[model samples]
Target: MTEQNEEKPRNFHEMELDDRILKAIAKLGWQNPTLIQERAIPLLLEGKDVLVRARTGSGKTAAFAIPVIQKILNIKQTARHQEIKALILAPSKELCHQICGVIKDLTIKCSQEVRCVDVAPQVDLSVQKPLLVERPDIVVGTPTRVLKHVKAGYLDLKKSLELLVIDEADLVFSFGYENEVKELMGSLPNIYQAILASATLSEDVKSLKSLVLHNPVTLKLEEPEIAPESQLTHYHLMAEEMDKATIIYALLKLHLIRGKTIIFVNTVDKCYKIKLYLEQFGIPTCVLNSELPAKIRCHSVTQFNQGIYDIIVASDEKALEEPGNYGEKDNTEAKKSKRKKDKESGVSRGIDFQHVANVINFDFPLDAQSYIHRAGRTARGNNHGSVLSFVSIKEKPLLEKVENRLKTGDNDSIFKANHFKLEEVEAFKYRAKDAWRAVTKIAVREARLKEIKQEIFNCQKLKSYFEDNPTDLQVLRHDKALHTVRVQQHLSDVPEYIVPPTLKGMGGLTKRNKRKHDFRSAQSSASRFQARKSNPLLSMDFEGFSKKKKKKN
Candidate 1:
C-alpha cells in the first residue's frame, strides 16, 4: 500500500500512469495535479479505500476517474468478456452524466476496450436492462435506480464488481439514501475497494465510515490562501417585498451582469415569474424548476452551459425539501412496483455551472446551509464571482444566521449589508411595476386561454354545436383574435382588467367598471325573486288575476 506522507508528484507526467492515459491527460490540458488530485490520485491508484474532502472544481472527478479507468483497462486486457467491474453513484442525473462524460473522455486513449453506461432515472429500465445484460465495464448512476436493478437481477453486482465509488457522499446522505447505500455496500463483495468523496463532512457522513469504508485513508487537502481573500464578494440589499423584483432588475442593469448569471428563487412559481419579468425588459432568460420535463431541464442546462442564454432563473424549492424514500420498498412482503419516479430537480447540490459570474438570491434562503450551497454555485476553484441577495426587512434574522455561519471570529463576515433609499429606486420601481403588470397579465391571459380551450374540448355539447355550425367556430376564432389584440394592447398601455375571467365576479369588480353594471340593481332583483317565492299572497294574486281576466273576456 502507498504511504500517504510520500512526496506528491509535481505533475501528471511524473505519475505512474499508462502512456495512453498520460496522452489523454495532455489532451485535456491538465498540465499539473490539483491539490486534491495530488493527494488523492496516488492513494486511489494504490488500490486503497480513500475518503476525500474537497470543494467543487478541485479536480476530484479526475482523481478517481483516471485511476478507475486504468483499473478497468487492466481488467479488460485479461478477459474476453467484460463484466460490471466498477459502479459510481451520484445524487442526481446531471452529475451522473457529468461523471460518465469525464470517465469516457479519460478512457478515450485506452488500448483495451472500456465501455461505460449511464444508468439514471431518465433512462427507461427496459433500455438499461439490456445494456446491463451486455455487461458494460463501468456503470454510473443514482443510488435508488442502481439499487433497483441490482435487487431485480437486471444488474449483477455480486460477482465481478471490483470498485464502488460514491461521489458527493455528503449529498447522498443528505438526499436520504443512507439505507440504500448501506444495502449496496452489504451486497457488494468484500474484496472490492470503495472511495467516498465530498465537500463537507457532516455527522451523517462520519457515521457512514463504519458501514462502507474499510480502513480508508482520509485526505483533507489544504486550500491555498489566495491573496486579497476569497474570489467571491457577497452583498445584501435591504428592500421591501414589492421592491425586490425592481431592485433585482435595477441591480442587473446597474451592474451590467450580462455574463452567465443565475438568479435563485425559493419556489417554482417565483422561478417562472422572475423569468417572465426579466423577459419584459427584453432580456432573454431561461427557467429551471422541478416541474419542467426532464428533457427540457437537460436541454436548458446544456444550452446555458453552451452560452445560449445569459441568464437562468432557477428555484431552490426541490433542494429545500426533505429527501423522501427514493424508490425503496417498505418490506419483503410488499409487491414490487415496475417503475419509480425520478428524484426532483434542483440546483443546490452537485451542479457545476462553469464560469458563473454572478448569483442573485432573489429570495432569502431557508437557512445557513441553503445559503452556503447557493453561494457554492459561484466562486468555484479560484474563479472570481459575486453573490447579491435580496433581503426583506422581516428576513433580517435569517440574514444574520447566514452571516454568523460564514463568520470567522477574526475576519469580517462574508455578507456586506446595504440599504436602498426609496428616492434612489423610485423611477425604476415604476418602470418595473409596469413591466410586471404587463408580463403577469399576459401570463394570466395565456393560462386562462388554455383552460378555456380544455373546457371547450371536454364539453360534448359545445363540440357538437361548433361542428354543426361552422359560423360559431369562426366566431370563436374571431374572439380569440380580439383577445390576443387586447393582450398586445395591454402590453403597451396599463391593462384595464387584470383578473382572469374565472375569478372575475367572485369578488367585486374593479372600481373603474363598477358603474357599468349596478350591483345594487342586481341585488334588488335577486331579493325580489326571493320575496315572490316566499309570499303565498303574490302567487294567489297571479292565479286570481288570470281567472278574472278570462271571465271578463
Candidate 2:
C-alpha cells in the first residue's frame, strides 16, 4: 500500500488537469492541497467514485469540490438551467449553504463553467426554479428537500445528473434518512459517479460505500496529535447544579480570555438563559440555535461571522443541522425519543467554528463522541483553541470516562478561571470582562428557581399529607428543604425585590447601593416578564397559584 501510494500523485497540481482549472485553483490562493484533497482529486477527476473519512475542518469540502468543478468545466453544459449536471447533498442547511459559498468563490475565478443552486428544507422550490433555471451546473441541497423535488418531478435528476456527491454521509445516515437517501440514489442514473465524505465513518457509511461506490479511492486524514509543547489545555470543574452559574461568573471576571468565545449547552433554554445572564451584566452577545427565526439565525451567524459579537451560545447539534425544535419537544421522553431518532437519522451531527477561540461545556454530552464533537468546535482548521467544562461531582465520573476515551490520561486545567483570564464574556460592553460569569450565575439561579418550584410542588403534596397524617419526619424534612430552596430562589431570582439590610455576614453592600438595589429588584420581575414574554425559562409558575386563586374565586 505504501509503495502504491508512493507511485500515486503527490499533489492536486500534479493531477492531470486543464489550465482553466489550474488558474481557478491559483486564483483562489490555496496554499497546497490537503492530504485528502491530494489523494482523492485524481481518482475523482478520472470519473471514479471516492470515499473520504476525515476529521472536521480537514478541507473535505474542497477535496471533493475541486474535482466536481473540474468535471463541470470539462463537460459541455448547455446554457439552459433546467438541468443540474451535479447534485451535492449535505446533511445540514448550514453545510449546504457553506458548500455553496465555497463553490461560488471558486466559480468567480473559473471560466463561467459552474453555478450552484442551494435548495434547503424551508426554502420554496418554486421560487428557486427561476433562479435555478438560470444556472445550469450544480445543485446543492439537504437530502429530504432535494429528494422531494426529485420525486415531485421539479428536478431533472435522470437526464442531467452526472455526479452525485454525498457530503457528511455519516451525518445523513445518522439522521435516519438512509431510506430516503437510498431511494434518491436509486433514482439517479447508474452511470453517474458517486462521491462520499464524512468526518467519521460508521456502519451506515460502510453499507453505503458497498452500495454506491465502485473501485473508489479511500482517503483518511487522521486528527493531528496534540503536540507536547502545545498551549491548548482541557479541564472540567466539579460543580453542584446550583454552583455552575457562579463558576461561569468567576471564569469571566479574570479577563484573560476574549475574542469570539463559544458556550455549548445541551438545550436551547440554557442557551437563552446564559445569553440573558451575560447581557444583564452588560455583555454584548448573540445566540445560534434552530428555534431562532430563520432570518434572525442567518443574521446572527452573519454577524458572528463578521466578528460583530463576542460570544455565541448554542447546542452542539444546532451548529450542524437545520435550525428547528428537534431537541425541545414538550414531552421530555418524547424529546429524548426524537433526539434518538434524529441521531439515528444523521441530522444531529456536529459543526466547527472558525473564529471560536474558547469552548465552555456548560452541560456534559452523553458520551465520548459527543464530548469530542463539543470540544472540536474550537481548535478548528489548524488554529489553537481552548475547552473549559463545568461538571458537577455527580458528572465527574462521566468526564473521567470521556477523558480516557480521548486516550490522554489527564489533561491539565486552570482551576482558577480567574487566574488564567481566559475570556472576557462581556462582549458588547467593550470592557465587560465577566460576562460569562454573570450568565453562569443566572444559569445557577434559574436552576435554583426550578428546584424551588419542584420542591414547592412536593411541599404542597406534603401539606396535604400532613393535614391527614401529621408528624411525618420524612415529609417534615422535605418541607424544610422546600422552604430552604424557596428562600434561596427568592434571593437569586428576586434579588432586587429582597432587601437584605445585612447579608448573612457582610454588614451591607452600602446604604445607597442597598436602596438602589431594592428599587432595581422591585422593577426587575415586571421588566423581566416584559422582556422575556412567555418563555418557560424566565416565566415563573407561581407553584399552583392559579389553582388557589380559582378556589378563592
Candidate 3:
C-alpha cells in the first residue's frame, strides 16, 4: 500500500532499451517507477549481479524485464543477432510465455524499430537451432529445456553473453533441482552477470549465492504486514474429503467468489479426484496436474490465465513443478500421501495468481511451510486474498502447528459449513446463470473422470505393494515399464525434463527413499515429524517454544 523507496533513472532513451519500450511505458500512462523497477533496474543496467526478493505483483517482472530488454537492444545496436546474448530462465512454460509476451508488447509500444521473440520448449526442437542461429535476441524458457538445448549442443554460449537470470529460484531449488541448477550455472561462461529473483528465499537459495553471483546487490521488499481486509477472508472447515466437496459446492452456489478459482490439493491424484467430485456437483472445473499432456496442461493454464475457465482444481505439486520439478515425476512421499508432501513436491511454492480472491486448501498443508506457500499465492501484488483450509480430526496437529508457526493471531477453531453467509453468492448466481451452469457441468464431468483415474492409481499401487519387498523383480520391472510409458507419454507431450526413465540412480532420490520406506526401514518415532523440515527457514517443533534457528545442520 505504501510507495516503493527506489528512484527511477532519468534518461530512459540512453539506457539501451528499445525506443519502443520507452514509448510503450510512456503510452501505457506509467509516470513513475514502481519500487522494484526503480531500485532494481539501475543495478541491472550497471551489469551488477542482483538478487531481488520482492512480494509477488510488486512489479518484479518489469523490474527485471526492463533491464533485459535494454540489454537486448544494446546488443543488437552493437553486435549481430546470430548468437543468443541473454537467457531468462523462468520456472514455468506459462511464465516464460507471459514474460515473452510482455517483452514483445512493450517493444511494440516503446518505438518503431524494436522487435522481440519468445522461445520455449513448446516450440519445435528442430526449429530451435535455426531460431538461435537466425533471430531470438532474447531467449526465454523453462530451465530444463533450455539446459537441454545447451547440453545437446543446440545452444552456443561461447559468444559474448551478458546476463543469466534464474527467476523463482526458491521454487527451482526447493523442488529437488539444486543439482540441476548448479550444473547449469557451472556451464555458463565465467564473465556473464547473474540475477536471481524470487518472492522468498530459502537456505538452498542462500547456498546458490556463492556459486552463481559475485558481490551481488541485494534488493528486498517485504510484503505488506497487513493483508487487504476487503478482498480476502480466512476460514477453516473441519470436514471429511466428501463433505469438503459439498462445502465447495455450497460456496460456488452462494457466489460472491464468482471468477475462475484454483482449488489447491496436496497431491497430484487428488487434483483429479477433486475436479471430478466438484464436476459431479455441477461446477464447471478442470484438473491441472503434471499427469496431463503438456499441451493440455498449457491449454488449461492459458485458459485459466485468460479467465476463460471458472474453476481449476489442481495439486500444489503439479502447478508448481513444471520447469521447477519437471514432468509427472512425483517424489516417493508424494506417491504415499499425494495429499500432503511439504516443500519437496514444489506445488505449494509455485502457484502465482494475482486475481485469485480465495485459496481453498482442499486438504490442509501438513506444516507451516506449506501454509506460507499456499497463502502467498493470493494476497499477492498488494491485493487482499482469502484462505479456506479444510481440516479433519486426523490433521489437528498439523493445523495447530501451522497456527503456531505463522503466528496467526486468530483462535484455532473448526468452522462448520453454516458459518459462511452465501446470500451474496446467490445474487451473482442469477447474473451469470449460464456461466455458472456450464462450470457446474464441467465440474461434474471432471469428477467422474477423476474417480476413474483414482481407481486406476489405486490398482497400480496395489500392484506395487503385492509384488514383493525390497527386491521384487516382477513388481519393479512392471512398475518401471509402466513408469517408462507414462514418462514417455508425458515427455512426448511436454519434453521439459529429459531425465532417463529410471528414477533410482539420481542423487535426488536419497531423501525420496526415506520418505517411501516401509514401516520396517523407517523409524516409527514421533521424532521424524519433529525433525522434519516444513520450511527451509523454519523447522517443525511439535512442542511450541524453540528459538528460531537459521544455522544449517
Candidate 4:
C-alpha cells in the first residue's frame, strides 16, 4: 500500500505532466495546486482508485480532470478508431456540461488529439449517436443518458474503457441513479479504475465501495470552517409565512442583497411564485427549476454567469425532475410517475456558480445537510459571501438544529438572529400583497382562457360555427370578461394597512365553552329566521326578503 501522506507536489509543473498540459495550466493563471489537486492528482496518475470527500470549490474538478487528460495523452494508440478511455458521470446536465468544459480547457495544448463529448438531455441523443461513432476519447454525461446510449448500441463502453469517474457521488445515489450506475459498472471492464468524489459520503455511497472499487484509497479533506476564513456571514430573520415575500421585497428595496444572488426555495411552485412576485416589483429575475426545458435551464445559468441577471430564484435541485428521454408515452399513470421521479432529482449538486455574493433561503431547508449545500453556493474559493434565512416561528427549531451543526466546540453562535420589524416595511408589505394577488389572478385567468380555447378547438361543431360566423369570433375576441384582469395600476399605488390578526387570550377558552358559544349563536340565528318566516312585518324589516319576493313576482 502506498503512503496516504506521501510528499505532495509543490506545483502543477513538478507533477511531471506534459509540457503542453503545463502550458495550458499556466495560461489559466493557476500558480499553485489546491490541496485536493496536490493530493489526488499524484495518486490518480499512479493508477490508484481513489474515493475523495472534499468541500465545494476545492478544485476537485481539476484534481481528477488533469490526471485523466494526462493519462489519455500518455496512451499511445495508432488505430483509426479511438475508444473512450475515460467516462465521467455527473448528476445533472449542467454539471456534465461543466465537467466537459473543464476537460476541454485542460486538453487545449495536448499534442495528441482528444475528442470529448457531453451526452446529456440538452443534446439530442440522435445527434450524440453520431458523435459517439466518431470514437471520442472521453465522455462526460448524466448516468441515465449514458446508459440509454449504451443500451441503444450507440455507445460502446464494454471494451477500451479504462477509467470511470463519478462526480458528486452522494447526489448520484440520492437522485435514484444507483441502478443505472450499477448497470453501467456491470457493462464496463472488471479491471477498470473507478473514482468517486463528493462533499459528503452517506451510507449508500459507503456500501457502493465494495461493489465498484477494489481496495481504493480514501481521501477525506477537512471540512471548510464556516466563518472566519471563508468570510461568510449568516443571518436568520423571523417572519410570518405571509410576510416572507414582503420581507424579501424589503430586503431587496434596502439594497441588502449585494452582487449576484440566488434565493433557494424547497418547492418548484414557490420558486416560480417568488420569481413572479419579485418581477412584479420591477426586479428582473430568472427561475432555475427542473420543470424548465434543458436548453432554457442551461441558458439561465449562462446568462446569470455572464451578468445578464442579478437575481435568480431557484428550487433545490433535489426537487427537480430527473433529466432524460422518457419515450413517447402519454398515459396518465406514466405522467404521474414521471412527476414523482422529477421531485427527487438532485440537480443543484456539483454545479459551479461563479462569484455568487449571497444566498437567501426563501424557504427554510428541511434538514441541516440541505442548509449546508445551499450555503455552499456562495463563499466559494476564498470569496466573501453571506447567507440570510427567512425563518418562520414554526421553523425556528429546524434553524436551531442547523445552527448546532454549524457550531464548533465553542459556545459562540455561528448564526446571528436578526429581527425584521413589520413596521419598517409596512407600506411595502401591502404593495407586495396586492402585486402577488394581481399576479395570481392574472395567472388563473390565463389558465382559464387556455382551457376555453382548448375546448373550442376540440369541438368540431364549434370550430365550424365560428368559421362561418366570423362576426361572432370578432365579438368573442372583444369580450370584456376575457380581459377582466388587467395591470391598470401599479402595485405601488395600492393602499396600505396593518391587519395583524389578534390571537391573544384565545387559549384561555376551552373546547366545551367554544362549542357552547357556537350553539348560542346558531340558536339566535334560528329564532330570527323563525320570526322572519312567520311575521310579514319582520320579513319586510331591514332583511328585504319581501322586496326580493316582490321583484321575483
Task: Report the number of the highest-TM-score candidate.
Answer: 4
The lowest-lDDT stretch of 10 consecutive residues in candidate 3 is 477-486
Expressed as tens digits, the lDDT of each residue in 480-508 for candidate 4 is 12222344324312222222222223221
Write model 3 residue lDDT over 154-268, tens digit each, in one string.
Answer: 7766565678887777667654666667677756787988888877767767887777878888887654422433334556657665455545654453232433356888666
Better of 1 and 2 by lDDT: 1
Q: What does candidate 1's lDDT look like per residue over 61-172, in tens digits? A: 8889888988877777777766999999988777787788788878888634788898874656776788899899899988888988888789888889999898888778
Residue 399 lDDT, candidate 2, scale 0-100: 71
TM-score attained by model 1: 0.73
How many pairs of residues collide in model 4? 1
Model 1: pairs clashing at backbone N, Cα or C within 3 Å: none
Q: Mind giving the per-residue lDDT tens digits that candidate 2 earns over 376-434?
A: 66655545556677786656666766666665435633222212111222222222223
Sort the predicted structures by TM-score, highest score first: 4, 1, 2, 3
> Candidate 1: deviation at residue 216, Å?
0.5
Whichever of 1 and 2 has more TM-score, that candidate is 1
Question: Candidate 4: which stretches are off by over 4 Å?
Answer: 1-9, 76-81, 122-124, 225-229, 317-347, 441-553
| Clash tally, candidates in order | 0, 21, 26, 1
Model 4 error, position 98 (Å): 1.5
lDDT winner:
4
Q: Please provide TM-scores, in order, for all candidate models, with all chains considered together.
A: 0.73, 0.68, 0.65, 0.75
Q: Rank the candidates by lDDT, best first.
A: 4, 1, 2, 3
